[model samples]
Target: MFKRIITLVILVPVAIVLILLSVANRQTVTLAFNPFEPSDPVLSQSAPLFVFLFAALMLGMIIGSLATWFNQGKHRSRARNKAQEAVKWHSEADRQKAKATELARSSTLPPPAESAPRG
Candidate 1:
């Protein structure tokens, strides 16, 4: 459920952008980075540039979110390991307690005579 909501949140903005772009019919100007002169015809336009920059920004945001998600995965694994260790320790303690009880009962019995009767 939570995953579905997060997916929707991410997609909503992208959908809105596409809708807006389709509705508007305007040209965009883009700056060309060259020492001599602007050559590329596509770079000479402005509308495409705005869309390109917005797309880049959105891509960066998605990448950052993925990085955070992977980091959280590491912490989650650490927590799981600790929980397993705790369970193992509890079982070991129970086993030791049982062994101690058995030993105590056995020790209560009388011991055989260590030496024969003296002359």
Candidate 2:
């Protein structure tokens, strides 16, 4: 519930701002890829200013996410190694426990007799 409220609080304002920005910047703008010709570009496309803004924002986010993931590669590898070590240790403990149980069952020692009550 708390998470949901926080998400709503953060997202609601951002959503409102983005909506307002898109509405305010609805004018068409041409994006030219050709640097050689300024007058007429061979590679160019026209789109709303907000569309480019959103596209750049999304691209930046994806690039950032990839960079973070790459940077944490060593940490992720360490975690995987630790998890495998834990599994190995757990299996070893189980094996030792089973061996102890088997030894106890095979023992020939008699059970202790109860002491008599004093009169």
Candidate 3:
């Protein structure tokens, strides 16, 4: 519930701002990829300014996500290795426990014969 409230607080304003920005910048603009030609380009696109802004935003998010994932590779590897080691240690402990239990069972002495109570 707290998380939802926080998300609403943050996202609602961002959404409103993005909506306003898109509405305000609805004019069509041409994006040229060719640096050689000033007026005409081989690779170009005409779209709303918001479209480019949103595309760039999405691209940046994707790039940042990839970079973060790549940067944490070592930490992820270490966590995996530690998990495997923990499993190995746990299994070893279980095996030792079972062996000890078996030893205790096998080494147990028989019950003494019953005797009458003396005054």
Candidate 4:
């Protein structure tokens, strides 16, 4: 809940700013794939400046995420190893508990039965 509030606080203004920026820069710009041919009809696209900005932002995010994931690979591996060990330990503990319970049951003697004769 606190995270949601903080996210809203941070994202709301950023969203508004992006919206305003896109609105202000609504003019279409031609992007040519071939730098040598500025007027290349086949290799050029006309799009708003915001489209390029947003595209760059998305691309950066994707690259950063991939880099972060790769950087944390060792940590993830360690966590997975620890989790497997923990599961093994838990199963061992359960087996020991079952053995202890069985031992306790076998070690204890049964109560003596009393038979009364009625007249």
**lDDT digits (tens) for residues 22-111 of candidate 2:** 999999999887788654656887899999999999999999999999999999999999999999999999999999999989995888
Candidate 4 local lDDT, 1-119, one digit each (tens): 99999999999999999999899999999888999998999999899999998998999999999999999999999999999999999999999999999999999988877778777
| Count of clashing pairs, candidate 4 | 0
TM-score of each: 0.38, 0.85, 0.90, 0.83
Error in Å for residue 58 of model 4: 1.1
lDDT of each: 0.81, 0.94, 0.96, 0.96
- Which pairs clash in model 4? none
lDDT of 3 by residue, 4-93 (tens): 999999999999999999999999999988878845755888999999999999999999999999999999999999999999999999
Which 10 residues in a row give candidate 2 its minimum summed lDDT?
33-42
Where does candidate 1 clash, by residue pair? 28-45, 28-46, 28-47, 29-45, 29-46, 29-47, 30-45
lDDT minimum window of 10 residues, candidate 4: 110-119
Question: For model 2, what is the C-alpha lDDT against the true structure?
Answer: 0.94
How does candidate 4 score on lDDT?
0.96
List model 1 lDDT by residue over 1-119, tens digit each. Answer: 99999999999998898778755634565666654668776545455555776677899999999999998998999999999999999999999999999999988978877898789
Give the number of the best model, judged by TM-score. Answer: 3
Ranking by TM-score: 3, 2, 4, 1
Per-candidate clashes come to: 7, 0, 0, 0
